[model samples]
Structures are given as C-alpha cells and as structure tokens.
Target chain A: MSIHRKNVLGAVFLAILGLLPLFLNSYWVDVLNSIGIYAILGLSLNLIVGHSGLFNLGHAAFYAVGAYTAAILNTHFHIPVLWLLPLCALTAGLFALVIARPIIHLRGDYLCIVTIGIGEIVRIALINNIFGITGGANGIFGISRPSILGLTLRTPTHFFYLILVFTLLTIFLFHLLEYSRFGRALNFLREDAVAAEGSGINTAHYKLAAFVLGAAWAGMVGNIYAAKMTIISPESFTFWESVLMFAIVILGGSGSIFGVLLGAALIVGLPELFREFASARMLVFGAAMVAMMIFRTQGILPPRPRSYDLFETVEGERKA
Target chain B: MSLLSIQRLTKNFGGLTAVNNVSFDVEQGSVVGLIGPNGAGKTTVFNLITGIYQPDQGAISFEQASLLRLPTHRIVSLGIARTFQTIRLFQNMSVLENVLAGCHCRMKSGILSSMFHFPRQQREERAAIDRALKALDFVGLRDQAENLSKNLSYGNQRLLEIARALGTEPRLLVLDEPAGGMNENETAQLVSLIERIRGMGITVLLIEHDMSLVMRVCEQIVVLEYGSKIAEGSPEEIQRNERVIAAYLGTEDG
Candidate 1:
C-alpha cells in the first residue's frame, strides 16, 4: 500500500474506534478495554518473542508482579494506584533482569522451558504467600480506582478512554522503537546471533535489554489491569495468561504492531463475541486458530522488510 | 608490532583437540591466508581470534591489548570484523539494514534517544545509513539496497556479507572461504575487491581453498594440517614447501 493510503486507512480506523464506546453498551465498552489491555501486553511480548526471537512463555510472571505490586501498595498504604505505575514497572523489570541473567545464555527450547518454569514458580509463590505480602491464594483486593485531574474514573466508559489514551501512547512509542537502531539490532541478533556479534552488535546485551523492556511494559499494563478490576488474585495470572499473550503476538504477526492489535481483537474480542456459541465456542475458536496458522504461517501481518530511500541517502552524503 | 598477534593458541573439544598450539601474526596492511585441507582447524583459529571460542592455552592480543576473555562483539568493536564460511546475512532484513547492523557498534544512540528520535540519534542514524550505503556501493550491491538479502543471488549474497563486515569499518577483515562456491567470474571479482580493500589499508585474513586466488592475492600464507601449522611463508615459498604440497596432494607411497 502507498504511504498516503495507509495513513488514510489508519486515520479512518482510529476514528471508528474512537466513536465505538459511544454506540456500545457498558459490557462492550469493557470488552474494548480488555482488547486494549491485551494489545499492549502483546506489543510488549512481541519485543522479546517477535523482534528478538526469544521464546518467552512466561510473560505473565512480569504482569503478575506489576499487578501485585500495585495492589499491595494501594491496599496496605493507600497509595493511589496510578502513582504506583512506575514502581510496578521498576519491580517487574528488575525481576526480569534477575531471572533472565543466568538463563539468557540458554538457547531455543531450553529458554522457553525455563520461562515456563518461571511463570509457574511465580504463581506458586503467590499462592504460598511468600514474604506474607501476597496474601496467599485468595490474592489482594480493593485496589482503588485511578483518578485524573481530580476526576475519579468509575465507569467502563471512563476506563475505556484511559486505556485508549494509554494504548495510543504505547503504539506511538513502540512504533518509534520498531524503526530505531535498537530494533534493527534485535532483528539482526534474532536472525543470526554469531553474525550479529561478528558485525559488532552485542547480542547478549540487546537480548537482555529487550527482555527487561518488554517486562517493564507488561508491568505498566498490570497497574492498569489492577485499577480496572479493583481486585486481583493468582488465578488471574496463570500460565494460560502468558499463552494468550504469546498467541496474540504470533497469531497477529510476531513483529508487527498492527498484527498484535489484530491478534488481540481476534483472540480477546472474538472469544467474547462467541459467548452465544455456548459450549461449542471454544471448539470453533480452536479450529479457527488452526486454520489461521495453516493459512498464514508468517502471521496475518508479518513485518515488512525495512526500506530506505537510496537517493535520500545519497543526497545526505553529498551534503555532508 | 603486528596488528593482531596469536601465540601458542589451543582449543580442545571434549576428547579432540581442534586446534593445538597454533601461532601466527597478522601484520599491518597485509593480506594473509590460512589455508589447509578440510578439518585442518583453520576456521577454529579464526573463531579463537574473533573470540567465538576462547583459547585453552596461550594468548591473543590486538594492538597489544589482551583479548583473552573479551566477548565476540567486543572483539569486533576493537576493530576486527569477519564473515562466515557460510553466508549468514539476516535473511529477512534488507541489504541496507544488514549493513546498518554492521554499523551498530560504530553508532551510539541509547534506547531513550532511539525511541524519541532525538537530534543526536537522528544524526547518528543518518551517518550510519551513509556509511552502510557506501559499503553496499563498495560491494556493488548499492542498487539492491532495499532487497531482502536472502533474495539476492548466491554471488551477491557473498558480496553482501563483505559489505556487512566492511560496514564495521574494521582495521582487519577476516573472511572464511570467500570463494567457497563462486564461479570463475565471481572469484575474479572477489580478487579485485580484496585488492581494493587492501588499498584502503585494511588488513585481510582469509581462508580460501582456491589456490590460484590465494596465490594471486595473499602476501603471506599459513598452512595447517590436522590442527597443526605445517608451514608459513609467502606464496612462492609455500608453493615450494614439501609438507604444504604433501598436505594438499598426499605422499606417493600413501
């Protein structure tokens, strides 16, 4: 597609989305909020899984850490949930750095297995109420709602706008990251680590940075999730949650932002729409997933190879 | 002093000694060849020098600084860039992006700056693109800059690897089997490309099986046999060395 047409299509899509909540009922608005949240989470996981080619089946561990951090702080100390967003991100990022340091050297399926173990371990820890801060299996409760400019956001409509704004901001920032030097480095290392290292890219460092940054973004999303639900538990962050996020990235197009968002809508929103299918819904969903995978092996919106204007580069060189 | 020095280097894989007590020096502004029969440990030595595999014994120093435990990327940043025996370009990336990846260590724009496209980041990116384009032009793949590297012909793929390495702006260029599968025409092109690279004053270290190409370009040659250095000399001297000839074409009795 031409750049102009793509921009126009994107603008039209955003306009439709912006006008959606007005027409929908509370339940559908909440569903949109869910899609937005999952979209951000998929984008985060895409950095590690799609961009860097790291198998990460334990992203929920980081999301859980963020949610718990916010929940604990808000419930025990009465801190505003919004105020804990950065802290949640810090805690999750640190957690990823610590856990990933020793195991980052493991290759392929080994790394994937280790991540799965991590997700399970975090869930079990929360269940056991380690350090007595996690409140055992029942999980923390009564997380206060977020407020903005002296307005306490209470309705699904209120949270929708908040999530919409946050999702837009995430898209903007991640789009920049996707085109940057760092993004190229991730793709390079993903393609061939030995060659990337030989070409002067610090492969290990870039991989770990991707891990930490992805985890931090997931953590921020966790804070929003806690505020939206006003309650949290170990059940909310099972290994299944991680699988959903992973599927969203893979099903949408591993490295493409639009693919992830589409994946999120299909995975999260479709399931909701299928509610009327009753017991047969999951069966249909499974068959649809299988068909999608077979039809689009590279995902629905695989990332396009980056291109630069040769004449522009030549002009730049001449001017220089 | 030599630009890169290796002394008594050895690396063993489990029960087998892949490289044993190998020693060599790459002098400044020289094209050197490490040639041998298959499984002669030539590539192992290259790996050791590039820090892919640490030497079990002895030392490697670049510009008089110890390279003992430095990582591969660190070694490249210290001015040694190499291509693989098998072309390892980022298959899904554009040719320009592959070269841009090679320019990574030379450009420094942190995550925040990159995300924001800050003035410094934009400036560095522009400079990197220019450098990458120049390298692509050098390898005569400038017109295919936006093509996915995997889509290039085999010969062009090999040239793309060279362009990627040159993007590093290295002091020493190490190529593993540059002419492994090239035709006569491609090999001829590579010979001139090496001369042009040498004219740019970058030291060249290569492992090539094509004797004619090696004889035509290499100023110094190191011959290895079964993980041991059998001979080291100029092309003419190596041509006369009995052991080097025997290693390549076996003894009459055998």
Candidate 2:
C-alpha cells in the first residue's frame, strides 16, 4: 500500500477503536482491552523476533517479572500501580539485560532454546517464591485499578481508554523507531549481521538493545494488565503466554503494526468469538498460521519496504 | 604519513596459512590496489585489516592507534570501512535506507532521542540523509534511491555497495573485487566512480581480479602469491616483473 493511504487507513482504524466502547457490550469491550494488551506484547516481541530476527521463545518471563513487580509493590505499599510503569519497565529491562547478556550471544535456534530456558527459569522462580515475595504460585490479589488526576479507571470504558492510550503510544513509538537510524541498524542485523557491521552498525549492541526495549515494552504492558485484572497469578504468565505472543507477531506479519493489531484480535478474540469451538479454536489458529506461512510468509501487513521519495524529490530539484 | 598501517599480519585455518606475515600501508588520499589470483588470499588481508579476523600476530594501526583487540563494528566508526567480496546489501531495505545505514558510524543520536524525535536528533537525522544522498550521488545512484536495494540491477547494486561504504565517511575505504561481475560498460562507470571517490579525498585499498582496470586506476599495486607478497610497485613496474607474471600463471615456465 502507498504510505499516504496506509496512514489514512490507520487513522480510521484508530477512530473506530476510540469510539468502540460506547456501543460495544461490556464483555466485548473487555476483550478488546485484552487485544490491546496483546498488541503491545506482540509489538514488543516483534522488535526482537521480527525486526532483529532473533527467535525468542522466552518473552513471557519479562512480562511475568513486570506483572509480579507491580502486583507485589502495589499490594504491599499501596502505591498506584500505574505509577510503577517506569519501575516495571526498568526491572524487566534490567532483568533481560543481565540474564540475556550471557546467552543472547547465542544465535538463531540456539538463542531460541536458551530464551525458553530463561523464561521457564523466571516462571519457576516466581512459583518457588523467590525471597518470600512472589506468594509461591498462589499468586497475589486486591490490586487496585489505575487512576490519573484522582479518577479511578474502574469501568470497562475507562479501562478501554487506558490500554488504548498505551497501544497508541506503542504504535507511535515503534513507528518512529521503525524509521529511525536505530530501526535501520536493526534491519541490517536482521538481514545480515556481518554486512551490518561492515556498514558501521554495532550489531551485538543493537541486538541487546532490541531485546531490552522489547522486554521493557512488554513489562509496561504487564503493569496495565495487572491493574485491569485486579489480580495476578503465575498461571497467567506461562510458557504458553510466550508462545501466543510470538504467534501474534508472526501471524500479524511480524514487523507490521496493523498486521500485529489484526493478529492480536485473531489470536485473542478468535477463541472468544468461537466459544462453541473453544477446544478446536487452537486447531483453527494453528491451521491459519500454517496457511499464512505458506501464502504470505512475510506476514499479513509486513512493514512496507522503506522508501525515500523525499530524497528523490530533493534530487529532482537539484537537477531542475 | 600513512592513513592506515599494517605490520606482520598473519592468519591460519588449520594447516593452511591464509595470510602469512603480510604488511602494507595505505597513504592518505591515495588509491592502492592489492591484486592476486584465486586463493592467494587478498581478501583475507582485507578481513584482517577490517577487524573481522584477529591477526594471529602483528599490528594494525589506523591514523596511529592500535586496531587490534577492537570489535568489527568499532573498526568502522574508527574511520575504516570495507565492502565484501560478495555483495551483502541489506536486501530488504530501500536503496536509500541501505546508504542511510552506512551513515551509522557518523550519526550520534541515541535511542531515546530518536524515539522522541528531539530537535537535536531531528537535525542530525536531516544531516545524515543529506550526507547519504551525497554519497549516493557520488556513485550515480541518486535516481534509484527509493527502490528496494535488492531490486536494483546488479551493476547498480554494486554501485549501491560503494555508496553504502562511502556513507560511513571513512578515512580509508576498502573494496573487494568491486568489478568482479560488471561488464565493460559497468566497469567503465565503476572506474570513474572510484576516481570520483578519490577526488573526495578518501584513501582506497582495493582487491580486484581485473588487471586492466587495476593497472589503469591504481598508482601503486601490491601482488600476493600463496599468502605472501611477491611484488609491490607501480602498476607499470609490476606488469614487467617476471615473478609477478609467473605467480599469475601459477608456474615458472614461459
């Protein structure tokens, strides 16, 4: 699609989403919120899995860390959960940086395997109740809803707007990053690390940075999820959660924002829509993914190949 | 003074020595060519100088600082850049995006600033594009800037590689077999492009199989035979050397 039309389409989609809560029933609205949360998670994973071309099956560990941090701190200190977004992001980012620092040096399938181990390790650590804080798999409760300017975001519409804001912010920020110098560097790493290094990009540094950023974004989303649900559990974040998020990124066309959003809806909403086929929903999802791989291997809305009409226009003017 | 200096560089893969006790210097703003037959290991020397391979022994200093122990990425930012013997453009990126990536070494905007689009970051970004465009113009790829890099014609792709390398603003640019696949016309364009790049005041170290192009463009030539320097002199002088001829033929007989 042309860049201009894509922007218009995106704006239209956002407008519909912005007005969705007023007409949709409570359950559907809540489902959309879940989709929004997953969208952020998918975008986060896309940074590592799609843009940087690293196979990471352990992303849920960071999400779990953030959710646990928010859950533990909010219950004990009564600090507003939303206020802890920065802390959530930092802890997850630092966790990824430290744990991934050693094994992130592994490439491709090996990296994927190690990340799986890391994710399992984090989940088990929470269940085992590290430091007597994690509640030992019983999980935590009584988490308060997020508020801004003293207004508690309690209703479905209020929660819709909450995750909506974060989703938009993620889209805007990832969009900027997709076009930024950092994004280009990541693309080079994705295509060929040696070539990227030859082009003067520090490939290893960029790879680790991508992991940190993706983890941190998911971590922030964890804060929102904790507040929205009003409870947290270890079961909520598992190896399966990582798999679902990775699937969303893949099914969405990895690096495409719209693709990811549509992917989130399909992955998060399809099962709900086909409640009669709840057992078969995963089978359908699997078939769809296989079909997508066969037909559109690049993803449904693969990020448009970057272009520079502006440069060509400037070149034209120079000649004229 | 030399822009780049190498001393006693060597590398081995098992029993075979790829580069053995090789030493060379690239003077500031001069075009020097390193030519050799297949498997003589001219590209190995480029890899060693570019920090892709740590020298088993000896030192590489660019503008009087040790290049040893530095990572490959750091080597580029230190004002040394190279192209591969095989084409290695980021095939999925736009042609312009590929060159813009080359400006990475010079661009200083950090991750936060870029995400936020801070004013200073915006300025650097614009400047970076302008620099990238100039490099593209330098290689006659200005019109093809908006196309996907992989879509470019093979000759254009080769030019795009140079544009990408020149985008790094390197003090010394290294090209490996740049004219390897080009036909006569493309080779002619490449010759003039190298001349234009040199006119921009960058030193060059090139490894090429095309002797005619090398003899025509290079002021000084280094010849390699079985991982060792067999000849070093002006193109005219080396063309007349018996050992150099024997090395090219892989035999001592007439």
Candidate 3:
C-alpha cells in the first residue's frame, strides 16, 4: 500500500476505535481491554520467539512472577500498585535471568522443553505457597486500583484508557528497538547464529538479552492485569496462557509488530464475538487456526527483509 | 613477520585425531594455502583457529596475543575472520544486511544508545552501511545489495561470503573451499580476488582441494596427511616434493 493510503486507512481505524467505548456496553469494553493487554503481551513475545527465533513456550512464568510480585508488595506493604510496575519488571527479568542463564545454551527443541519445565515449576511453586507470600491456591486479593491525580480508576472504561495508553507506549518504544542496532543483531542471530558469532556478535549475550527484554515487558503487562482484576491466582497464569500468547505471535506473522496486534485482536476478540457458539467456540477457533496456518505458512504478515536507507551516494568527491 | 602462528596445535574427536600436532605460520600480506586429500582435517584447523573447536594441546597466538580460550566473538575483534567450507550466508537476510552484520564487530553502540537511536549510534549505523557497501563492491556484488542472499547463485554466494568476511575489517582472512564448485573461468576470477585482497594488505589462509587454484594464488603451501603437516614451502618446492606427490597419489601409506 502507498504511504498516503496506509495513513488514511490508519486514521479511519483510529476514528472508529476512539468512538468504540461510547457505543459498547461495559462487558464489551472489558473485552477490548483484555485484547489490548494481550496485544502488548504478543508484542513482547515477538521480540524473543519471532525476531530472535527462540521458542519460548514458558513465557507465563515471567508473567506470573510479575503479577505475584505486585500482588505481594501492594497488598502487604501498601506501595500503590502503579508504583510497582518497574519493580515488577525487574523481578520478572531477574527471574528469567536466573532460570534461563544455564539453559540458554540448549537450542531448538531442547530449549523449548526446558523452558516448559521452568514455567510449570514456577506455577506449581506459586500454588504450593513458596516463601509464604503467594497465598497458595486462594491467592492474594484486595489489591488496590491505581490512582491518577487523586482519582481511583475503578470501572472498565477507566482501565480501557489505562491499557490503551501503556500499549501505545510499548508500540513506540518497540518500534525504536526494531530499527536499532541491537534489533539488527537479533535478526542476524535468528538467521545464522554461528555466522553472527563469527562476525563478532556474542550469541550467548544477545540471546539472553532478548529473553530478558521480552520477559520484562510481559512483567509490566502483569502489573496492569493485577490492578485490573484486583485479584490474581495461579489459575490466571497457566501453561495454556503461555500457549495462547505464543499462538498470538505465530498467527500475527512473528516479527511484525502490527501483525501481532492483529493476531491479538483475532485471538482475543474473536472468541468473545462468537460467544453465541457457546461450546463450539473453541472447536471453531482451533479449526480456524489450523486452516489459517495451512493457507499462509508465514502467518498473516511475514516479516519483510530490513533495508538500511544508508545507501546515499557519498556526495563529496567529484572528479578530485 | 607472521600475523597468525600455530605451534603444536592438536584436537581429538573421540578416537580419531582430527588435527594432530598441526603447525603453520601465515605471514603478513601473504596468501597461504592449507590443502590435503579429503578428511585431512583442513577445516578442523580453521575451526581451531576461529575458536570453534578448542585445541587439545599447544597454543595459538594472533598478532602476538595468546588466543587460547578466548571466545569466538572476541577472536573476530582481534582482527581474525573466517568463512565456512559450505556457504553460510545469513540466507533470509538481504545481501547488504549480511555485510552490515559483518561490520558488527567494529560497531561500539551499546544496547541503550542503540535503542534510543542516539546520535553516536546513528553515526555508527551509517558508517557500518557504507563499509558494507564497500565490501560488496570489493566482490562485485554491490548491484545485488538489496536482494535476499538465498536467491543468489552458487558463484555469487561464494563471493558474498568473502564480502561478509571482509566487512569484519580483519588483518587475517580465512576461507575454506572458496572455489569448491566453480568452473575454470570462475576459479580464475577467485584467484584474482585473493590477489586483490592481498594487495589490500590483509593476510589470507585458505583450505582448498583444488590444486590448480591453490598452485596459482598461494605464495606458500602447507600439505597435510591424516591431520599432520607433511610439507610446507613455495609452490615449486611442493610440486617436486616426493612425499607430497605420494600423498596426493594415495600411495603414501603403501
């Protein structure tokens, strides 16, 4: 599409989105809020799985770490949930560091298997009440909602705006990262790790950085989720949640940020829209995912090869 | 003076000694050839030099610093770069991108500065792209800069590998089987390319099964048999060495 046409289309889409909360009921608003959350989640996962070609089936381990960190700090110490976003991210990033450090050497299916075990271990530990902090199966509740300018955000519309703003922030920062030198190195890592290392990129360092970055972003999302539900349990962060997030990255065309948002919309919003299907919703969804993969092996939007606009003819030497 | 020196280097994979007590010196601004019959461990020697396989015994020093136990990435930063036996281009990446990635060693942009597109980082990125273009131009693939690497033909793929290695700005360039499947015309082009690279003051070491290419471009040739150095001399000296002839004729053991 031409740049002008894309901009016009984007403007129209934003206009519809701006007017959506006005016409939709609170239930649908809540659904849209969830979609925004998953969109952020999908984008974070894309940094690792899509761009770096690391199979991370245990992403919810990091998410759970973030949610539980916020729940404990806010409910026990009363630190105000919003203030804990950075702390939540640090905890999850550290958790990923501790867990993924040794196993990062294992590539392909072995890495995937080890990560799966790590996620299960974290979830099971939370359920068993490790450190006497998780509140076991009942989970910690009564977490306070975030307040902005002395206004406590309580309703669905309030959270829709909260998630919307943060999601936009993620999009902007990740866009910068996508074009950055680090991002290009990650692409090289994904394509041929040995060659990347031969070219002087520390493969181990880059891979670990990708995992930590992705996990930190997921942890930030977890902070918002804890505040929204005001209660978080082990059930909220299951293996299935990790699978769904992975599915979103895959369905959206792995490395493309815009494609991830589209995937998140289809994955999160479609199920709610087809609530009329009742029990058949999941069956239909599974069938649709299978059919889509068959039709477009590269997802809805495969990543385009990156081109640096640095080919400008050096304009200084004219027949000197 | 030598740029890369190997003394009593050894590597063993289980019962087999892949590279057994192999030693050689690649002098500055010279093209050295490492040649043998198949399975003579020429590629293994390259792997050891690049730190892909750690040596079982002895030491490697490049530019007078001990390269023993330094990581592969660190070795590249020390002005040593190598291409693989089979073409190992970043297949999904564009031709320009492949060289840009090769220029990664010279780049000093950290994670934070790069993410923010700070002025220093932006300048480095531009310099890297220009250097990449220059490397592509060196191998005559500059016109295919934006094409995906996998779409290139066999000869182009080999040149692209050399270009990517050159983009590292190495003092020593190691190529494994640079003209493996090329016709005579392409091989002639490769001979001149190596000569051009030497003219640029970079030392070259290559492992080749093709004797004609090796005899043509190499100033010094090291012959190996079952991972041991059998002979090392000028091409004329190697051509008349009886053991070298026997090794090639497959009658050395008999």
Candidate 4:
C-alpha cells in the first residue's frame, strides 16, 4: 500500500518493457528472455553475497536444481508446467535447506568450497547416472512447453511474457524481503555474524532463510529455462556457471537489486553481442573484477544508507 | 531463588583455566558488580553465563531453570541479556536496526510468514520497531535512529550496545565494561543510568574498571584474581578487603 517512488518508476519501466516484443524479432526476443533469466539468478545470488555478505560459489547448484526438478517432473510424471513452477521452486528450496544445513554452517571460504562441491556433485550425478531417464550426458530433449488452458507457450513472444513475469516477480519479492525485518537481520549478519548473534538473533535460521529463498528464485528461473530450451543437460549446470553467477552479484554491487540486474545484463548480454571477441571477454571480465575489488570494494552501487529514524531510541550521545 | 545463580562454573582454554570454579548470585531488582584486575576472568564469567563458552563444570540457573547447556540466543530469550567489553554492534545497520535485531528471538511468526510478509509478520515487524524505539528512547539516542551505528561517537556506541541488549527485554542485564574508556562525567552519567536500569526492577551485573562508579552504584561486588574468586561483599566491604587490596597491588607491582 505504501508504494515508494522507486517502485512507481519501476512499474512504469515494466509497462514500457511489456510492449517491447511488438518491435523486436523472435531471435532478439529470445535473447531478451534469456537476459530476464540471468537477471533473476543474479538478483538471487545478490541476496546472499551482497546483502547477507555471504560468499557463495555454487549458486548455480540451486539454478540447476530448479531446472532439473522441472525437467524430471515433466519428463517422467507428465506434470503440467504451470503447476510445476512452484513445485520446482519448493524442490530446489528443500534441496537448498538440506545442503545448506551443513554447508552454510561453515562461513567464508569454507562455505564456498562446500557449495562448489555440491554444485559439482549435482552436475556430475545428472551427467553420469540415469541414462534412461535423464539421457545422461546427452541430456533430456523433447520437453514440451508449458500451456495454459488451450494456449501453448511455444512462441518466443509467449515465453518472453512468462520470463518477464517471473523476473518481475522475483524483483518484487527481493525488494519486499530486503525491506523487511528479516532482511534487516540478514544485513546485521552480513556486517558481523558474531555481533548479530549477540543481539539475540538465531543466526543459523536467518542464514538458512537466505539460502533457501535465494535457491527458490534461481529455481523459478530454471523452470523458465527448461520450457524455453525444451532440453535440460548437465553441461548447462557446470561449476563455472556457478562462478559466473557470483560474478554478476559482485560486479553489480552485492546487496543492490538493481545492481544485479545491471550485472546480469552486462555479463550475459555483452558476451553474446561480442561473440567475435569471445576469447578475450572473460579475461577482461576477470581483470575488471580485480580492478573493481581494488578500487571499489563496495561495488558499482553503494550499500543502502543507514536510516537514522531507526536509531531514535538510543538516548545517549555518540561515543565511538 | 536469585534472578541468576552460577554454581562451580569453570572454563579452561587448553592449559589456561580462564575461569575456575566461580560461583555467584544476582538478586532480582539490584545491581551487582563483577570486578578484578585486568586478567581476573570477570569477562569469562559473563561469557559462561551468556552461553558463549560452555562451562566445564557448573550449573547456571535463571529463574530456577538450568541454563548450563542452553545456546546463547536461548539464554537471552529467557530474560538474560548482555553487552560486550569491546562494544560489538551491527555497525552497518541503523542504530534502530541494531536494536531491532535483538528482538528477533521474541518474534513469533515462523520463517514462512517472514519470507511471504504475511499480515501477522508485518504486525510483528511493526511491534518490533516500536519496541526497539522504546529501548532506544531509554538510552536517549532516539534522535539518531537512522545513523549508521559505527559513525556514532564512542560513548554513544556503548549506550547503543546496551540499548540493543535492552531490546531483548532481559530481567537480568550483564554489562561488560560499561564505562571502559569514558570520561569522569560520562562515567557519572553511566552510574546514574545503571541505577535507573536497576530502578526498572531488572537485575544488573556489570564488569567495570571505573572504581568510583562501581563503588558508588553496585549493591554487591565480587572480585576475581587469576581466575579465582578472592572476595564477595558489598562495595564498602570489598574496598577494605585485604585480598582485594593485594590483587590491585599485584597489578601495580607487575
């Protein structure tokens, strides 16, 4: 009900974007759709890395979990994709909870290493096992598009709308969560876990919440990918893909939602547009990341400014 | 029963026994001071009571319930809260947010409600904010609610830490060095503040170095020397104890 000015501008921008498919070709529209997916993944990653100050190296694990869950259910059980979206998100979230319980308990580099292991283990299992159901390394094909009533979501225009809706929803949800009390707890954890815990927070629960919610976002995007590509493969869920997601979050500014979107567009959109110079792209990105870390450790966007109205209760004068 | 009772509590760090068989009691609606020389293990006792360190051998009971094996947050939720000697605040957060985080244990909405922003969750969140504001108001920093805590002056930061702990609505509040680096006036103000806190009917346990302030405000004093309890008495009794005299002289001689 209390829509901020930023939300109003965002709504207007979305209204303009809704009409873009009328002007663009199917190929361009498909590329745009992919951008939406990447943006969602980037935003989700941002929650843990940027806002929560978690260093995640295996976010693609959740993305893969989402994609594979949708793929498996549709391919085996013939579940309708519309109904499968939430299911896939829940599956990914549950898997995240299970994996995060042990892995998220470890902080900093240890967490990164464990998540990397999870991502690798999941991808390898998908590739090596279940030759009959998953097509193993060859991957699953002929995955049908989602349909609503009698309308098939096979065309790029239709898929664009679907991806846009999910992406917008993800953005909306991320913003809402960031502004909530839970989000404040995450920010406290990010600043200093020990201090946050000392403040009487159940630090473990909040960290788990960040991991689960982030996975859910990635999973939703994964469902969209499964429908758009009509195929799901282990090759698509490589560990490097996880690293790339990390890159987007860092490049954009860890806690900034808009930063993630910009990061995703830069990382995913630029490479395709500059395919001729593909070999140098990653090298440049790596260099830029290094330089950015050195020059702008806070990233492109600054962390949210601390609001003083929130501090009105501490009656003492400033000390240190 | 006392508001807080520590019996035979012991903490060992490898070969170092940081706290050895320390036992004490905090009466409800009173201020108690834990004081000693720099290496006296006053902080270690606070840590043990707050569940930051597992006591090797002892029972800690609050309001007649055993707290020896409970986790830190659980201890806090049971109406025991504390501030650190080094002032551990959520520096990047607004002062109010730092305090609001202290209210997390009291939040009843499940994680599902939090993520979805359910109506109940919103109500709880608002209530938390209102409660945090009241805690901030108690500390007199209500005007700086939105400022990053790290930017505040040192004195205010100390107050902020206490206000944050107060957000937990503790019946027993432990402050580790509330006046560590403060000036004489600040220490005097702090002495009054501790009295006001005790006035609220909450038990107060503090570790302090300002001898004048501690002597003036504490109803009872417990002294530690090299991880051992040397004396326990009223402030006037502690100041005249031969063992207390020797402990301070030992540091001076060193």
For each model in turn, which proportion of the native inter-chain contacts is also found?
0.83, 0.75, 0.73, 0.54
Sliding window of 10 residues with minimal summed lDDT for model 3 chain A: A311-320
Error of 2 at A222 (Å): 0.8
Models ranked on lDDT? 1, 3, 2, 4
Q: How accurate is candidate 4 locally (lDDT)?
A: 0.84
What DockQ does predicted model 3 obtain? 0.73
Tens-place lDDT digits, model 4, residues A137-233 = 9888777878977899988999899888888777777777776777778888888888777777778888998889889878888888898888989
Candidate 2 per-residue lDDT over residues A60-98, each given as its tens digit = 999998998899999999999999999999999999999
The alpha-carbon deviation from the true structure for residue B184 of candidate 3, after best TM-score superposition, in angstroms, is 2.6
RMSD of each: 1.6, 2.2, 2.0, 3.8
Decoy 4 TM-score against native: 0.94
**Per-candidate DockQ vs. reference:** 0.81, 0.66, 0.73, 0.50
Cα deviation at A184, candidate 1, in Å, is: 1.0
Grade the docking of candidate 1: high
Tell me the whole-model lDDT of each prediction, alpha carbons only: 0.93, 0.88, 0.90, 0.84
Which sections of candidate 2 miss by over 4 Å? Answer: A1-12, A309-320, B252-254
Candidate 3's residue-wise lDDT over A180-231, tens digit each?
A: 7789889899988999999888999999999998999899899999999999
Clashing pairs in 3: none
lDDT of 3 by residue, B1-254 (tens): 68899999899999999988988898999999999889999999999999998999978999889899999999998999898888888998899988887898889887778668898888778778878989998999989999999999898899999999999899999999999888888888999999999999999999998899999999999999999999999999999999999988857458
Give the Cα RMSD of candidate 4: 3.8
DockQ of 1: 0.81
CAPRI level of candidate 2: medium
